[model samples]
Target: MIADTELILNADGSIYHLNLKPEDLAHTIILVGDPERVPIVSKYFDTIEVRKGKREFITHTGMLRGKRLSVLSTGIGTDNIDIVLNEIDALINVDFTTKVLREDLRSVDIIRIGTSGSIQGNIPVGTLLASEFAVGFDTLMQFYVKSYTAAEQKLAEAVNRHFSNLSFSPYIGSANPALLKQFAMELPKGITMTAPGFYGPQGRSVRTHNMYPDLIQKANSFITKEGLYITNLEMETAGIYALSNMFGHRALSINAILASRLHEEFCANPAEVIDSAIQYVLNRI
Candidate 1:
């Protein structure tokens, strides 16, 4: 089943979207939201094999502690994730040049190191959070053919009720369990509350009238029966987690805390916080 765009490429032997080629990548991939931040994370690399950028997507392939890795920018949202994820999967699992599904598909470990705000006051700025779960609040899931079980449906219904009462839609998502067992001990672990944005979507104070004033409280207090708390708030975790899980890939999110929604103050120096997060994940992964 070859798609029309079999070999996604640029004129100079670079990838189409990422502007990179096979030799320019490594098995371990780290995804970041901002393209400018790609080099910041890759700076710690022992040796940089390649560097390429296309539009909002930037990639740096190198070695860190002798672990071959690719640091790529997935831009700001889940929409960008769809392109990068599919292409990376095609490169690793499907053999893009030939457009053939490899008999033995190689699974690349993906880690998202991003900045986020804390819904729970306990998680203050400058702390790094690892998402054990992600509650999706985006449109990426509608693309997939879904068949939710009765139990799953009930949970979704409850989530809907909670959102409807508050007049905001909360996406239900979770991180890769395999990743949790691997690096859970390294960072402060909790379920990440994946939000759609930093504005009114997350109950941020903009120029317009916003929804529930107790949005963060509602999120923090609404715990699943098994005891899952909404710990962090970011844009793409739910989409990344959901899609990666559906495709049989492992994914984890390590968030550098920038603000506390409860306290309403962003970290004075977010650069140091994000830097610390990168080092932590690099060492752990």
Candidate 2:
């Protein structure tokens, strides 16, 4: 039996952070980093049936092309990803009334549509990319007991050896192969580096000094034995992939490239790029 302290729930029997019950969730979920983007993804729905939110988490469930789907926001970073993914897994797999795990466990398809910066100069602004794998600079995955596959282990070793000057070890997580094959056939795909913050963690300096000034150069030059490169930088993909694996759910991160870290360029029309990326995923999903 799970303790109340461990699996906390609201008085309304909805999952604590997400404020959603099992019925309120759909089998396919779209995760966005911004709360306002929740409605942007759902606006194309045939009919929106549920709308719920708490803090930065907002959810909308509706139908599109006779398929039921839901869009939820996780704000930013792996910390928020931890809360949103766990609460969502509990909503589908645990009985809130009984405070126990359900006999018949369920799995959901999680798709992340978010903006990111291209670490490779070849991948220019306004390009849409898919995260085949993510290298987490954050420590979120350390708390969870996970076994890395042979390929994942090899990739992690490469990243660690390349960034040996860094203080902490990085971890690797991957997208669901089934989802990758389904949606990434026509898109450019590569490894994404998930940073803990937008500024210093991602090697940006304002007033404060950056610890690893050559971080972007090292990342851009990193190549795997399999010949893959670290292509983009973002806040959530690694944690999303990690927890989705832990929960037995299918997860994919589709990124809209609005900036190029390698070339120091930002897209002028960010909204148009985001809207197009949203429509692209919607049409395929």
Candidate 3:
């Protein structure tokens, strides 16, 4: 049987697929998708310490405004998320580094600051969108559970029939209100759509063309009776919300709206938006 942890690399602890260890992180963490962005975030740090990596998973732990935090890259998709979330939880919750369980492990605050395109016109470029909720069109959760909640099922039924969506179904998801609310003053709040990919998954055109030409339009028009909106499109927010919630971590996604294909415009300078989010979170957290 596969166990929770098996020491392999350093021999003193479990070496996750990412190869990160207990000492490699801080309680306040920021996760980006690109390894290059790791240092971009770390540049705001007050002091530098541990730096480790394997493949696209690059890690750097440092102090920002006297607050120690770690910034790491997950490469892409829910697959990498599955690996990072579980092992990070283990590092703090389990006692594999020792022989006893460390139930009192410090809870890490995880915030994903990344770039995404706005599905709607109102959510324009050069703004930071803090995702209050994420709607997943990915099947990562399917391996864990066979059924969806009533609301999730309802969302699926609605979106599926409208767009003839398949291969993956929609799942309603949310982040920790406390965590999201903490940075409320800094970023624009919205309901983000977590699409599986940039091409067919998000209604993008290639030489072969998109099967659902109106899917993006349909998405821009969607809303629940509760007045929730899907304002932005991204790859990782849904997985982040679902896994982080399940594992008892407060998580949020701050997406820089760099492009709105509907308007055919770009952010002009998206790095400014990213800087805003990084500075805001660094201060608030």
**Best lDDT among the predictions, by candidate number:** 2
TM-score of each: 0.89, 0.98, 0.88
lDDT ranking from best candidate downward: 2, 1, 3
lDDT of 1 by residue, 71-188 (tens): 9999887788878887777667765566578899777788999999888878888998888777777677777864544444555666676667744444455666677777667578
What is the C-alpha lDDT profile of model 2 across 1-285, one tens digit per residue? 889899887888887899988899999999999999999899999999999999999999999999999999999999999998898898889887787899999999999999999999799999999999999999999899988878788999999999999889999999999999988899999999999999999999999899998899999999977899999999999999999998999999999999999788999999999999899889988
lDDT, each prediction: 0.78, 0.94, 0.77
Judged by TM-score relative to the true structure, which candidate is superior, 1 or 2? Answer: 2
Better of 1 and 3 by lDDT: 1
Q: Per model, how many backbone clashes are there?
A: 7, 0, 1
Model 2 weakest 10-residue run by lDDT? 7-16
Better of 1 and 3 by TM-score: 1
Against the correct fold, how does model 3 do in TM-score? 0.88
lDDT of 3 by residue, 123-242 (tens): 778877888878888887876653445665666566666556555567766767888778775667777887777788788787757767777788888877677667988889888888
